[model samples]
Target: MSKVIFITGGSSGIGKSIGEFLSEKGYVVYGTSRNPDNMKNHPFNLVALDVTNPKSISNAIAEVITKEGRLDVLVNNAGMGITGPIEDTPTDEMRKVFDTNLFGAIDVAKAVLPIMRNQKSGLIINVTSIAGYMGLPYRGIYSATKGALELVTEAMSMETKRFGINVTNVAPGDFATSIASGRYHTPIFENSAYKENYQLNLDLMDAHVDEGGDPIEMAKTVYEIINTKNPKLHYKVGDFMQKFSIVLKRILPDRMYEKLLMNHYKL
Candidate 1:
């Protein structure tokens, strides 16, 4: 039987690309969207799922398993983006992002583990971000959520290995997608302290996304990880510099890495 694959946030962006690619390769693909009815003519299956809601997560997973009898892989890709000065960003907004990015992913994994454990085989791939490796100006909260998930993936992998469940993270850099449009950007208040630098960095961020690599690159990377005998704990997909930034952080001193980022953002 072909492996059954389920992807969260699959109505569009990287999740949609992954689902379509896998469907074409003969895998049973089920993707989720908060408003599945709004999405039209999608190639593979699209189910209703709201990661932030436990009931929704359970129901979606159950629906997939009920139809396929087994779920072999889960791509935890349902996430939203946020950008703002740490000081100015609303605390409630920060919690909201954390709820969706970190806790939501965790809840989804929690729902799947029991089923996988019974089968004695499964894989969970958390979609993180290159930003997760380090804090970025105007995007600190977004970075923190993804960073926390990365560490969680590490701890969960160790805990779940005995049960034949593989857990890992895929941190992608800027990709040409609708993410920018959906991202919650704390207003650049005219009188706020960070107005100038914040606006500048916002433009820079948009430019990077506009010129970023294709989403298919990430989809192909996910497919490879699924087929690997023993995949690494973390995988990153992006342009050379985006991936290299992580290496630079390791080898360079703290201030030096900070300087590079400030210079790039023209701060």
Candidate 2:
């Protein structure tokens, strides 16, 4: 039988691309959305799932197992975006992003572990972001969420290996998607501290996403990782500069790298 694949946040964007690609490759693909009823004419199966809700996560996984008897691959792609100066972004808003981007992914992964253990095999791929590698201006919250997931994936990879389940993360740079519209933006308050710079960075971010590479590239990378017998703990998919920035961070001094990022964002 073809591998049964489960992808979160599959209604659109990177998740949708991954689901469609895998389905075409003959995998049994089940994608999740908060309101599956509203999404029509989708290629792969989409079940109602809200990752922030533990009960919803469990129900959706149960539904998948009931239909397929096994889930061979899980693409933990459900996440939201947030942008604002760290100080200006409300505490509750920060918590909300963490709930959805970090805790949500963890809960979904926890739900799938037992089933994969019993089957003696499975793969979990967390969709992180290139922004996670550094703290970008006005996008600090979004960066922290994905960055935390990256580290968690590392720890989970070590723990799950003995159980025959593989875990990894794919950090993609800006991809043409609906993320901009979906992300929370702390309004550019007129008299607030960071008015001019904040607005400029926001415009810059939109441009990057607007000119981003195709989501199909992310799908292809995920497909390649899924097929590997011993995939690495972390993978990055992006253009030369985007991926290289990570490398630069590793080799550069603390203040120097900070300076580089500040220059890039014109902060």
Candidate 3:
């Protein structure tokens, strides 16, 4: 039987790319968006789903299972971004980012775990970020969300091990996508403490992100993970420098690492 796959946030970006790529690979694919109308022209099945809503998550999974005998893979790729200093970011705004990036992914995983547990085989890949390993200016909250998700993936690996379920946290540095268009930037004023360097930080952040590698590269990585007999706990997709930074942080002293980041951001 062909493998069955379900992807969240499939309207565009990494999610959509993965869905399309995997479909071409001959798997049964179901991609979800809160507004399926937005994806009407897409080739694969498009289901209306809201990751932040439990009922919507449950229903989407049910739709996939009802149509396909079993779900072989669940890719939690739906996420949102927030920018600006933490102090400038409102509490409610942080909550919104966390809801979509972290909590929502958690809920969707919970919704699918039961089905996989019963089947005794499945793979859960949560798309995290390279920022999760290091804190970045103007994107602190976004970093926190990814960091928390990575930790959750670690704990979950152990929790679902006995059930023959696989969980891997895929941390991407930056991929060419519509992510910048969806960011919730914190309000900044003329008198703001970060005003002088705010725009520069934002520019630096954007420059790298805008230059991010193609999303198909990540989709290919996901494909490899799916076919591999034993996938590792974590996989990172991005530029060499970004991946190197993870290693540098590990070996370099704390102050040294912070200095490197400060210089790179021109702070």
Candidate 4:
């Protein structure tokens, strides 16, 4: 029997790629997007969902279960990016970012856990980012959201282990996606305190996106993780440089790592 996988944020980018790739691999994939009208006749089942809305998530999951009878995998891939200095960022925007990236994932997981626990088998993959493991200048709030998600994935993995459920956090580094380009931008020149640092941060992000790794490769890595009989707690996918950078960040001193990032981004 084909396994059923449910994913959020599947309208585009990495989530969309994963949905297509997995469906081609014979999985009964159900992907959720905020606007389902534009997703008609897609390769996979596209359901209308707004990650920030608990009712929307609950209804989508209930609809899937009603038709499929079982959900073997859940991918918390819905998220958005907000970039600006921590002090300059609006408090309401910061909360919105966390609502979608962290709390939203938590809500979806909570809704799906009962079904998985009852079935005594399932996999939960939380799509995090390299930012989750390390912080950057303009991405303070975004990093915090991902960092919280990574920690949640760790705790959830431990809690779900005995129930035959596998929770894996996949952290991809600087993938070539519209996420970076589509990030919410606020004019730092308007804020006297952040004016001096505004251009520097903007240039840094542009350079990073120019050299980002391929999203398709990240999608392939996700496919591999899903097919694995026993998935690991975390999977890092990206170019060789990204893997090396992560290693250096893990092993080097704080000052050294900071200097490396500064030099790499020329910030």
Model 4, 1-267: lDDT tens per residue? 999999999888889889989998999999999898987678789998998998999999999999999999999999999888777778998899999999999999999999999999999999998877788877888889998999999999999999989999898887767786668776675646766666677877777777787778767887888889888888888777777777888899999999987776556
Greater-lDDT candidate between 1 and 3 = 1
Error of 3 at 173 (Å): 1.1
What digit string (tens of lDDT, one per residue) describes model 2 on residues 186-208? 98998889999999999999999
Better of 2 and 4 by lDDT: 2
Rank candidates, lDDT, best first.
Answer: 1, 2, 3, 4
lDDT of 1 by residue, 1-267 (tens): 899999999999999999999998899999999999999999899999999999999999999988989999999999999999998999999999999999999999999999999999999999999999999999999999999999999999999999999999999999999999999999988889999999989999999999988999989999999999799999999999999999999999999999999998888
Report the C-alpha displacement of residue 7, candidate 1, in angstroms: 0.3
CA lDDT of each candidate?
A: 0.95, 0.95, 0.91, 0.87
- Assess every candidate by TM-score: 0.99, 0.99, 0.98, 0.95
Q: Which residue ranges in model 3 land beyond 4 Å of their true spot?
A: none
Model 2: pairs clashing at backbone N, Cα or C within 3 Å: none
